[model samples]
Target: MDLDMAQVRAFVHAAQEMHFGRAAGDLGVTQQALSKRIGRLESLLGTKLFERLGHGVGLTEEGRRFLESARRALAASDDAVATIAGKDRPLRVDVWGHLYAPTRTLLQVAGRADELRLELGHGRDLPGAMTALLRGDIDVALGRIHPPLSPGLAHRLVRLEPVDAVLSTDHPLASEPTLRPEQLRDSVLWAPGALERLDFLRRFADRFGVRERSGSVNLGLAHFLTEVAVDPRRFSLVPADMPLPDIPGLRSVPLVDPTPLYAWSLLWRTGSTHPGLSTLAAACAGEAGRSRWLEYDPTRDWLPDLPTDRAEAHSG
Candidate 1:
């Protein structure tokens, strides 16, 4: 029996979200239409795929079993279509954080600039983009990967650059050749919206007694500079190589005591077979290989010694 692709898409989306309303919204269809499509699919399969649970829904036993098969079928169908089409139409890419400038330059220099159909998401945040990739919302995502990466995800390191402290010109520390991590004690550090979620930063904050303040979601470089310019007490950390806006009042100072490095990676689902993904990954790898400044030495000790817990607790 031939299955309707639209019905399959609706079922897959509904199964992923576990909420008919959200699933319908994602699919851009009304709840009534989504329900009808799912009903039709269940009738065709001759099994109840989902069971309503109070305010939400969940997959039935049959659905739990069918989900794997359904995913495989959908993937195979997508591959078949891509193969027949002769060209991958649009390769959706999600870029995380303020790394867009460097990423774009790398792609352009690598001669794969045309491959990106950019759908930038969750700037400087990886979790949201990772969720999107797992849900098949995008073909690829570029961002930093914290340790303990999920099993279904595959990643390739694209670049590593030193982290710098962005300070207002009027700030006392602005003219310092470099600031030590300890100098930031009692100071409010401006972090990208999701930067605080990094385990390293959490540990660092607890260790160094630095207070972190995050700006609005997806804050761009221009706005970030503006925030720093207006507030002398505010500071931010970013990749040293990241292109900064020409805002006269802002300066990026190197962090020296414990040199932190920001790593960027190309991420995709482990079993993804999108041709564009392969090409893009190769291009990124090539650009990284040729770049003199992006190499990272894993064995080097980069963090400063943490003070005792008593000292840290006593610190303001």
Candidate 2:
């Protein structure tokens, strides 16, 4: 027997959702019915698409390869049906986050006259957004990385934002133009609750000598600065060029010693034939709005002037 469109649709939906019940809900069917359909499809294909891992389901390595083909097939099928039905629709691509403002400017520069429409999505950070990109939920991601990225992913530097030691305006250090690393040795910091960032914190702490730390993901940059502003005893590292919040109590003082800098990049799956990827890259690297990370010097080689976005060095 041949695998029908319905079966393939269910398989693809299951892979994306990673939950039998949710996939069934998406398809307007019972979990049992969806399970049977997926099983039948797997039997026809002679390979399992998912692995039962505790309460959740994960795609097998083979399933990952199949997903790309499945997505392309579905897209083609949709295009054919739309053509036959005499309906025209826009191609959709997803963008995530504030890390890459140049991307937005590029899209706007293309003007509304262009045929392509971009759909933007926001996320907490690069890691969360990149996961969505991998699952085919989103097309592109603009995120920050210390170094090192996944093997099959590609990225280009968008900017090299410098970090500053932000504190309350009344704080003594705030009056200074720049602060030394030793100034922060005995200072307290409000840190993110994420475990993934803990290693970075430890390394930074050892280098700068952070004496006290508090873990609170609930506190955003605004709140962290607020605490410092009110008490004048706490501080947090913030991007140097990032506009200091309008709140009267806060100010960002540059860290002169051990100045930490971060690279923001655009990421995409290498094998992806998605048109949006190239469109995004061109926009980001446009003539007027080239990546902010580039050091524009008339004498320097333009190619090497930009920060390296090689995947191996960015993988975390």
Candidate of highest TM-score: 1
* lDDT of the candidates, in the order given: 0.68, 0.62
Q: Estimate each model's TM-score.
A: 0.76, 0.69
Task: Output candidate 2 Cα RMSD.
Answer: 6.0
Candidate 2 structure lDDT: 0.62
- Residue-level error in angstroms, candidate 2, position 281: 1.1
How far out, in Å, is residue 189 in model 2?
Answer: 2.4
Residues 70-95 of candidate 2 have per-residue lDDT tens digits of 76665555445645552333323444
Best by lDDT: 1
lDDT of 1 by residue, 267-292 (tens): 88767767777777766666655664
Residue pairs in steric clash, candidate 2? 147-314, 148-313, 148-314, 148-315, 148-316, 149-314, 149-315
Which pairs clash inside model 1?
97-123, 97-124
